[model samples]
Target: MSLARRASAEFAGTALLVAAVVGSGIAAARLSPGDVGLQLLENAFATALALGALILMFGPVSGAHLNPVVSAADWWLGRRAGAGLTVRELAAYAAAQVAGAVTGTVLADLMYGLPAVSWSHTDRIGGNLWLAEVVATAGLVVLVFALARSNRATATPAAVGAYIGAAYWFTSSTSFANPAVTIGRAFTDTFAGIAPASVPGFVAAQLVGGVLAVAALAAWYPQAGRSADAVVVPHLTEETALR
Candidate 1:
């Protein structure tokens, strides 16, 4: 795919993810204010399900990164192929994701009367919040690497989605799997934003998680080192065999 096409896919996928998160937050706010915990649970489940489906739907066309962190992870894995994105591509994709997420939050706020800041439980700040981000992102990266390395995984996308969905529920941080999404959600002051003060910690945690996942993958698949590059994201080309 051309750069424009890839960017477009990233934009669309990010839009869908943000829409789901914002929409779920709105629904949760209205459906069970007293059961806030349950509301979060529902949101996480929905987010995971949506993410998995989207990856399956878009992975073939544009690799379905939808997150700057994922793109970075792919680069680190040495999977940038002839189609690897440049800094410009990364910036554009990240910008689109943040923009789409902000739009979704604004729309949800208008429709559901979500508080601009205090009322929206969307803020993602605090030590606990940072921990959550780390764990959630770790699971995401680990899963992607594992699936990309194996023939069985490459043959099907459902497992990828299933793993993500499960991790959201299992992880302490309801899984803000995308850094761009996390930053964009912060702007809404809704149930999604991690406190800006806490953003750095969360991001740091995520980076650590990513590194650990990469290390683990390296140990499991010795052949992966054959490529000189560090990151090894999945790629598409007619000439290359699936395995």
Candidate 2:
């Protein structure tokens, strides 16, 4: 697909993803009432399932990265090999992701009869949460790039979704591992929202984690590295060929 087409896919995929997250969060909060744990369960389960479905829907067109870190990692790995995303493509992907996230949040809030563009006041900043962001993002990058390196791209949708679901419980930050997603979450004041002030720390931690994951992949799974096309599942990838 052309860059424009791929970017559109990225935008659409991310919009729906944030909708799943924020919408489910609002619904869970309403239905579960004071039970935070149950709300989380409902939100995580819905997000995971929707995420898997989105990846399967868009993986062929854009790799369904829907996350800047994944795009950056893929570009970095494939830069020298000539199959990675161009600098222009990377910028487009990032911009689209952030915009899509905000749109999704707005749509979700509208669905719940809230203002379309309300800013969240939910405080999610702290040392432990920062650490959790690092851990969560690091694991996510490793899992994604590692799969790409090993040519196991097709398995990524289910595996990545499952990991995110588990990370919601295991990590202190509820695993806002994607910068775009983090930004989107800051737009709503609800069960799944995060304060704008906390976004910088979370984004920084995620970027650091992504860098570490890239370095780790270079060292430990060097053989898994491939051309830019190998970064994720594309339309004519090995996974599709196998099927």
Candidate 3:
């Protein structure tokens, strides 16, 4: 895929991801504030599943890396060969992801009439939250690299979805797997966000998780280094044909 096309795919994918997150958070806030935790769990699981399927579907046409962290991690690990994302592409995608999350949150706010990511999620700090972030992000990155490298999960997108869903309950932070998504969700001011003050901790945990994921993949899936392409095929009408 050309650079332009890849960037476009990343933008659209990230937008969709944000929309799913914010939209679901708003709905949960109004329907069952008490169950917001479960709601986020479900939303994130579904989003990851949807994202994985979408990536598989679009991987051939575009790289389908909706998250800058994914793209950067893949490139750094030598998974992206001919089509690694450049600095400009990463920056653009990150901007789009953040904007998309904020936009989705605003729209949800309008519909739910709850303040966007307000006091409900404020001061929501604890070791569980941090540990959850670490585990969730680690699982997510591990899944991405695993399926892409092993070719087991690439043919079917269910693995990513399943991993995400399970991670939500198993991990704490309702599985805020992606940094971009985490940052974007914060804008919502809903139950899904980590307060601005808490953003740093979350990001640090996520990055560490991502790095650990890469290390784990490198150790467990050595072939990942020479993989044809880092493809996270989404379940779509059009499937990616491997080289």
Candidate 4:
């Protein structure tokens, strides 16, 4: 597949993901104002379902990595093996994801009759939350790549969605594992918002988690980590196969 097509898929997928997340948060907050736990559950369910659906729809076109860290991790593995995305493609993917995320937040806000853009006020600043972000991100990265290494690509959407849904309750930070989604969340002051000031820490923690997961994968699956044909991304058409 062409790089442009792949990037487009990433853009669309990420946009839809943020829209679901922000939109669902707004709806949940409005519907269950008195019940924080209920709000979280509703948001988590919507986001988890939407994320799986988006991945299933876009995976065959772009690998459905709606997160920038995921793109970076894939590139990190592919570079040494010369089998995955090149540096330029990685940059393109990251940019598209960020733009899509922002767009999705704006769309969600518009749908809810709010400002197109606004800085979030929900403060998620704390070592505990930071640590939770790290754990959440690391778990996500490990789960994703582990499935790929195990040649269980077809199981990714359901597995990933289920993981995210559970992580919302299991983690203190509500598991904002995706940096692009974090950035998008910063655009709203609703239930899902995370203040912009808190974004850097969350992003840094996520990067650390992704890097650590990749390292672990390399150590555990030495052969799969190095094999060009071992990649189990959803979209690996004949054109994508390294000759």
Candidate 5:
């Protein structure tokens, strides 16, 4: 696919992913007032379902990354092998993903009759939360690349969705493993939103986790770079393959 088409797919995918997250949180809060556990369950289920569906919908076009860390990992792991995105493509994908995330948050808020930019005040800072972010993000990176390396790329949509859903319950930070999503969630003060002040710590933790995961993958699967083209899902065309 052309860079324009791939970047467009990333934008749309990330937008809908955030919408699922924030919108579901809003609906869950309204639907199950005062029951935090049930609300979280509702939000997790919706997000998982939406994530799987969105990956299936956009994977063939753009790999459905929907996250900056995923895109960066793809580029980093595949650079030597020339199998994944170039530096230029990574920058474009990250920009598009972040923009889409913000747009998605706005859309979700508007759908719920809320302000477009409420600015979340849910302070989610702490050593435990930061540890959770690291664990969540590292696990995500490992799962994504490991599947690609093991020739299970076709199962990514379902597996990734399941892992994230599970992580929501296990992780203290509710697994906002994606930096773009973290930034987007700052735009809303709803259930899924993280305070803008908390974004930096979460993002830093996520990046650290990603780097650690990549190092582990490099050690375990020295040849993993060969499969980086299929991270998330194979979206490369014959034309791009030749490039």
Candidate 6:
């Protein structure tokens, strides 16, 4: 596929993923008023199902990364083998992912009759939350790459969705494992929003988690790079084939 087409897919896929997350949170809060636990359950369930569907919908087009860290990991781990995205493609993908994320947030807000760009006021900073982000992000990275390496890519949609749903309850940060999504969530003050001030910490912690995951994968799957082209999902192009 052309880079433009692939990047477009990334943009749309990431946008819809964020919409699912932020929109579902809004719906959950309204539907289960005064019940934080129930609201969370509703939000997590919706987001999980949306994620799996989005992946299935766009994976063949752009690998449906929908996350900056996932794209970065695919690039870093596959660089040596020349199997994943090139540096230029990585840059494009990240840009699209972040932009799409913010757009998604706005879309969700508009859908709920809220301000399109309401800055989030929710404070979500703390040691525990940061640690949770690390754990959640690391696990995501591990799961994504491991499945690709082990030739179980087909299971990623269901497996990843199930993992995130579970992590919502298990992690203190509610598992905002994607940097793009985190930044996007800051645009809304609804149930899923994070204060703009808190975005840096969450993003930084996520990056750290991604780095740690990469190191662990190196040790556990030394030859994992050979399968980097298939991370998240397989979408081979003539360009990658030539590489």
Off by over 4 Å in 2: 236-243
Each prediction's TM-score versus the true structure: 0.78, 0.94, 0.79, 0.94, 0.97, 0.98
Q: Tens-digit lDDT track for model 5 on 43-124?
A: 9999999999999999988888899999899999998987778899899999999999999999999999999999998999
Q: How far off is model 3, as Cα RMSD?
A: 4.2
Kindly report which residue stretches of model 3 are placed more than 4 angstroms away from their true locations once superposed. 33-49, 56-58, 79-83, 86-89, 110-121, 153-156, 234-243
Worst 10 residues of 2 by lDDT: 234-243
Decide which is better by TM-score, 1 or 5. Answer: 5
Supply the TM-score for candidate 6: 0.98
* Candidate 4 lDDT tens digits, 172-222: 999999899999999999999999999999999899888887887778765
Model 3, position 66, has a per-residue lDDT of 62
Task: Kindly list the per-residue Cα lDDT of model 1 for residues 60-144, writing each as its tens digit.
Answer: 6567777777666565565434434456666766676667666656665666666543333434556776677777776767666
lDDT of 4 at 226: 43
Question: In model 6, which range of ten residues has the least summed lDDT?
Answer: 234-243
* lDDT of candidate 3 at residue 119, scale 0 to 100: 27
Give one digit per residue, the lDDT tens place, for model 3 in 1-243: 445565566666666666766677666666666776667655665566666666665566555666556666666665354334446655765666566556655555666776654522565468878878878777777777777676664543577667766776777566777777666666656656667777778778878877887788878986664442454543221123333
Q: Arrange candidates by TM-score, highest first: which order?
A: 6, 5, 2, 4, 3, 1
Steric clash pairs (candidate 5): none
User: What is the TM-score of candidate 2?
Assistant: 0.94
Which model is ahead, 4 or 5, in terms of TM-score? Answer: 5
